[model samples]
Target: MPRFGEDYHHFHSQPEPSAAYSTSLSSWAPSEQQRSLPPPRWSSSASWFVPPTRLLALLLLLTVALQPALARALDEEGEGSGDGGKGGDFSVDMYHIPKPFQFVETPRDMQVIEERAASFFCHTSDAAEVSVQWRKNGQAILPSSTTASAEDVPGGSVLTILPKMKDNNATFECVAENALGDTISAQASLTVYEDNANAIPEGFPQFRLAEMEEEEPDKFPVFWPLAIEVEPDVLEVNCEATGDPEPKIKWFKSMRPLELKNPRYSVLAPGRLQIKISREEDDGTLYSCMAVNEKGVVFSGVFGLYHLE
Candidate 1:
């Protein structure tokens, strides 16, 4: 028997391979010749088809590259063209954006006869997302059988309260709230008047100003100016009167009969004219209210309304 090294040399030296066998072996080996040949049809088609993992990686790169361009397009569409520009077709729902509440009109100072119903209104710029509540003397007012009742109205809220002598000089305010923050309105006061026990027998209408407590029950009319000058928002000009038959009230502006159509100018109640002042045209305008019954017609003293600078 041969040694291990001797046996390996013996196997290698056995015989020279045939020409056909040598050719076949060289063709099967990895060499330049194998590489030079055209690939099989199946292999060429499979090379063009990408693998799942590599395809996903390419998609991620494309998305990242396009992100900045998409953002710029959206911003350009929303930008305003000028002061009066109405932006693109895609309108942002203003309701989604949080905005602080603002007041267009606040409650006005009121004077009402004892046992009569008094209405105080609060108007807001945008009411879709705003909530309103009425307060009395810095405390929240809730609805009850004998207490003030608050109700939601178009663009704002209304508070109705039946007053007694105890309610005189009570301060009232309205608070509005929205997603961003809340706003508190300027305070207004309520003045309650009691019936006089020593009343003269009422025959004809006699006019009395809100500042005055009483008037002589006469058939003739008298007038007085407003107690103080006030700025815009809401103003209640009241003309109190007494008569055997209740008097019908009418309001005038600049010495002419006021045509009350819009909510800006309306009578909140008899003898009480409520005006929502907004335009420059309303400045320095004289306002007066009249009380009329079958006996006679009485006009209150004229007062001018001006918008503060």
Candidate 2:
């Protein structure tokens, strides 16, 4: 009911709010019980909202939990691929291993004419990686005389020699070697004969001896004992003799004179005979040599030639 002027003056005269009163009215002034209570929960619609850091932490936990399962799945897929996932173009053959050298064909004993070329042949398996060496009389021969053919597969090696009489009975062997081991071939021998001993005599003509002043006792030709069993690729026999005059010799097979014109048969001076290639027909055949001169005639012991098993 006061006048307007008086009411305005009274409102201006009222005191301003003090710091203590403001503190008492502030919403931050909470009691002990309210402080002990949990914070207020958000509304249901807003409950799904989460801080970025919390979301990231949950994702990391999920990843760690699934790691073992992912690894197992990858391992299973690799096994199903059939190569165990070794990958990157690497390969291995577990079943096969390198092998040692082995002989296929061994050299054979041979007889060659004097001053002629002699050849020997030998073969081995796994030739590509093998190295061949020729040995004679237990000494290594030079490689210049050796020739190898068919390098990529099992093949043969040839040894050629221009032989002399000194080479008679020379033993030769072939050695093939690889990373694994060496293979030694059986021994082979060379028998060399003089060309003059292989030459054929001309015609055998009858001759008369001139009378001498002093009469001498006639010395007939004689032969030593011959081998009972002879087996060789080439048949060779010598009919040695002792006589007053040099004796002329003739060879016979099975009681018949050998075909002198046949290329396989060779007759040399005094009495060496050779059959180039002995055949099955030559088996069990008897061979003999006859010697005749002005004084007398003689027959050598019979010999039977056979083939080796």
Candidate 3:
């Protein structure tokens, strides 16, 4: 029924035979023990086969003419079928699908899944509306063959490929969304070959933007363009740095770590291992940042305190 649909519900439109049709015929069919006997008139014993053969043909003809009655009897017995078969509407589906509806920790960012092992699937129940977002770690992927249809309503959005190579462990994710709230998906990972491979590998897990952090309103650092803009009785300046996985900022003054101190200034963000300095004589000095991560430390743009000019 490929021309129609592969579903079990799709029975041909013609009427189906009754269940009782097979069973009831057994009762009406001829019995072998009572089969008609051979004629006594000088006949070979082999001729005993002729009468039973003729009786069989007669019974078959009778059953053919009476098929309608047999079918009707089945209907009375609740075993008859209708066009497309009434039983086809059982409407019970028990397809086995993965459940528990949770995900493992997302793979590390910037990692690629190896070829062959690099395979993934995307899913969405709202194909007519919002779609499944493919995130490596937490980034979206665009495909040239992206497709959807209500006819295939809630269609499965899948991506499967045997990557030719791999370099790092990779995590793949598919997120399904609709007018309802979005559902973040569980993560799947892949293993890849060493970096020496000619190809970087396929099916890299998606990259993720650093998680955004919250800041305390009063403690948030502010940059002033003018010294007079702040209190004339300024005793010290405190800075607070906030970032994901923490950002370490080294305060610099005059292109170097400020060398003077009055013990009045203090760093608000302890994670930066911040140091502060203050001096009445150096009130107008310039200060900036030397921030660092796994890569290395770097300075921020210079900011001036009290302007001399």
Best by TM-score: 1
Once superposed on the true structure, which residue ranges of model 1 sit more than 4 Å away at CA?
A: 1-100, 197-309
Candidate 2 clashes between residue pairs 3 or more apart in a chain or in different chains: none
> Candidate 2 residues 1-309, lDDT tens each?
344445445555545544423354454454454345444434424545678899999999999999788777767777777876543233456987765556777777765545444456577766575667778998888645432111212354666566778887999887777656655566688776554422312321112221222332232212343542235465567775545567677676654556678987767555667676556677788877665554434455567777767
**Candidate No. with top lDDT:** 1
Model 1 Cα lDDT, one tens digit per residue, 105-199: 88777755455455676888876766787889998887663667777765577676778789989999988875556655667888765633232
Is candidate 1 or 3 superior in lDDT?
1
The residue pairs that clash in candidate 3, if any, are 103-186, 114-166, 115-163, 115-165, 116-162, 116-163, 136-205, 136-206, 137-206, 166-193
Candidate 2 has an lDDT of 0.58
Worst 10 residues of 2 by lDDT: 203-212
Output the lDDT of residue 86, model 1.
Answer: 39
Instruction: Report per-prediction Cα RMSD to one decimal.
Output: 18.1, 27.5, 26.6
lDDT of 3: 0.41
lDDT of each: 0.64, 0.58, 0.41
Task: Compute each candidate's TM-score over C-alphas.
Answer: 0.37, 0.32, 0.22
| Model 1 TM-score on a 0 to 1 scale | 0.37
